[model samples]
Target: MSPMILIALILQICVTNVITGEYSEVVHNFKSIRKNVALSILVIDGDESNIDSSSLSSAEFVKVPNIEDLYIINILNSLDKNIFTSLHRLQHLKIEENELSYIGPAVWAGLDLEKLSLRNNQIEKLDNRAFDGLKASMIDLSNNKLRTLPNKCLQSLRLYKLTLANNQLEDIDLETFGPELAYADLSNNLLTSLDVEVFSGVYALLNLNLSGNKLTSIVAAPTLKKLKVLNYSHNQISVIAGNAFDSYNQLMELYLDHNQIFRLNHQSFPSIAPIKKFTIDHNYLTGLSDELLNALDNLAYLKFGGNPWSCKCLERVLEFIRSNKIGTDYCESKLIPQGHSCVNYYDKCYGNETKILSQNFEIYKNFIKHYEC
Candidate 1:
């Protein structure tokens, strides 16, 4: 049978119900249905009123014997401690856009959940044992009022993806998450710096985004050996340690643009054998060393525009781009069709002088050799 026919057959055989109202009214409506019929899915979108927990205490009133997914949204009052304790077979639970600010530890004790999303709420604190017995693989707590992650808040869980973006986070304890994390986003917060030991146990981490924050530096711990993509853009970074990326052997793309960086040391990068794209545009950089140019021998895409480039220093970079045939459309000039020129031209170099890199290679090479760093 085709997939559509198979889905239709399944829908014909299964029973699904959607309940929306105040919690007491939904329970009354659910009780109106015939007993002993297993429910496949239950979605309860609460009205903007406090939940009446007393109405949901009995199994006959609110029991969903075989529910696979449950979504409850816009609940106004705090959750009872045993609200989800009876949902032993629940696989996915989403309770979003509510006024919930805290979750007790034992609320989700027996759930066999796989994904839990509490997004767009007023959550400010979570107990350490809040997620103790869940089989959750992904947790999203974005757009909340969270200022700090409690210690061991995510301990002993099997989460592979965690999103804590757009919160008021100022600092995070490293021991909050486990080693099974693969993707984490902590952007758009108030973090000033991250401790190097924060990622010591996350060996499986691949993508880490810390953009749109107040960070002043890019320091990577030695444990991020498998990191592939790192985004540290839109920060206040002015200095990058030379060995900041020495441990990232599998890094593929690095974004350090939109900062205040003026220079990069020769030892700023590790082996670039696997790097495919590198961007440092929109900064205060005036020049790049020959050693740094040599390190980017394998990069495919490079962005060096939006800077106040010195004419003499720009000549060396142009020579490297010409000799290696680095394919890029950024540095190209509109006036001269031959080669690229500085955006803000200095008196020492003219717009037509940039063409010397390709037209007169030896003379340009000699000229760059005599120029000092």
Candidate 2:
């Protein structure tokens, strides 16, 4: 235990501490890198330092900077071709705010990619073979300039929801969607006429939005028995065929608002074993027929507001409304010429406050005497 022995022991202890510290630091750094799937080209604003394509992982999602002008061709070439070489395991891919035109053929070839979003792009056309190798279930192609979809373009996917709202499609042929299509959004378009055969075999469809279009009339399908919701708002529909809804027994909500309709026939809706709801607002209705009242056996909800309804001698439907429990509030025009009352020759010419129809009293006897004499 001299000075020389103590100095040698001190030197050994310092050297051992340095070695242990270096080993611990190296192990911690290695573990951190392994935990994360190494990313590539995380361009915050196209900064050159953030472009590192060599250390990318195959299973990682890499977000690019806001380079909307870069076309899809350059974006595809920037990635390592080997990264997307095996196209079967890709699950999610989003390319937001790009100037991508039509998706060419074989772009997604041999891929089982699901849940794709191509929002805020300038795509004008959707090539039919663009979705050749995808078996996706959910696809969002909203906010594009697509004019039409080719027949049978989407007849392969087992999709659960397909949204193509806010586009420029003027017409739609329902045959483009496969039979497995369950939900859809075709609203905010310029569609004038929809092919009835497009929904011929789509028995499993649950919800549909054809609102905000130019539909003049609907040729109802007798085979859409499983349809639950149908929206045809903001159109030019004037006449609804008598047997248009003969087969939609399971429909729960039907919207036909903000249109140019004049009459709602008694046989407009089908007689389902279960009840249904109907909306017929904002139209040019003249009167409600008596046959239409008898047809409403199980109508739970009905809205006929915001229309130009006429009040004439044939306004017996108002009396019918007071007799039964209407589905919705049946409002009468207080400013009509007859003041919510109908005057006929068989009844007395009473000016307002006449709630009862004089069918068996002096009014009937006077009408018979005038006609018989």
Candidate 3:
């Protein structure tokens, strides 16, 4: 047989022996394997107590010249700096459910990694150059104890999907991430407010989630022009600047539910593309004016329930809802009933009385045309 075929046969036999548990010691197994064959995939998972760190260190996997994918799960020890030093061709690496608390610089210095996931770990800190040599396109560091991102940690990476959810991040610098990033999820954090410069260089971003935060206002920013979907729900937002979404012509879906917004600026949605889904339910809104209704001409779906609708303003909103066929039961259903009753100036028109008046738009329109708020 030729040398290449002979080497392949020997490597196959060694792998079979390793899988059948013939080798009693890990170091012996590593030493017995054919070193000429490249190790393309390696997965090590088990209880940390059973693994011998000395044997792992002696295995010399770094000697393999073409290791590509590596997954190490439930390992109790911190990541060894030498594990990936010689893996110049490594592409995907996942290390989950570990006891790792910190990642120092030069841990991944020599690999051309593409996808890296360190999810579900106790990682609390990252050095500035921890990700220095990696060219990862997708990085998921979710479900960790990270309180902050290190400066220049993500400065030069060409990332497409980055998820930092379920952390304690209170703020992030605009220049920390490169401009080519497309999808980012910063939800379930401790963010109190986001400045307009937070999205300054991210022009290709398509989806952004900022829910479950403590934000109070929705400020206008010009860098979110290409965003298609936004989730700003579950926040303490009470004010939205008129130009908050001025140049965001590509936004299609928006979620503003469960906020403290009592009013909206008339030009809040000036000159944007047709919105497919828009929800403002469960807020403190009291009325919707004609100017706001006209600006939402391209709105195809809406959720306006759970607001204290004034009787006079409720009639006009109901007329807009009826005219646009907003709901399946628009004409027959009571638009503002129970939780959405007339309050303050129109206190007498409450409960079923507001409901009955809202069901008839033509008469309600003529009745309200001469009426005053």
| Candidate 3 residue-wise lDDT, 71-155, digit = tens | 7677534665545776677788887777777887767766667788898888889888888877788898988888888876886
Superposition error at 48 for model 1 (Å): 9.5
**Ranked by TM-score, top first:** 1, 3, 2
Report how far residue 277 has shifted in candidate 3, in Å: 1.4
Q: Which stretches of candidate 1 lie over 4 Å from their true place?
A: 1-38, 46-62, 312-341, 344-373
> What is candidate 2's lDDT per residue for 197-265, written digit by digit as tens?
877777678888888888888857766677788888888887788877777778788888777676677
Residue 325, model 2, lDDT: 45
Candidate 3, superposed: residue stretches over 4 Å from native? 1-41, 47-49, 52-60, 63-68, 311-373
What would the TM-scores of all predictions be? 0.76, 0.63, 0.73
Off by over 4 Å in 2: 1-35, 38-93, 110-114, 273-275, 311-373
RMSD of 2: 15.9
Better of 1 and 2 by TM-score: 1
Q: What does the lDDT read for residue 254 in candidate 2? A: 84
Which pairs, if any, clash in model 3? none
Q: Write the per-residue lDDT of candidate 1 for residues 1-373, one digit (tens) a residue.
A: 9999999887755433233221212322324433433665565555644554222333542556566676666644466555676666678888788778887786676676778888898999888777766678889999999999878778578678899999999998978668999889999999999988788788888889898899999876788888898989889887788888888878888888877776777686786536667777666666898888887777776666555556677777767766766654443422123354444433233344433323433423443444354
How many clashing residue pairs, candidate 3? 0
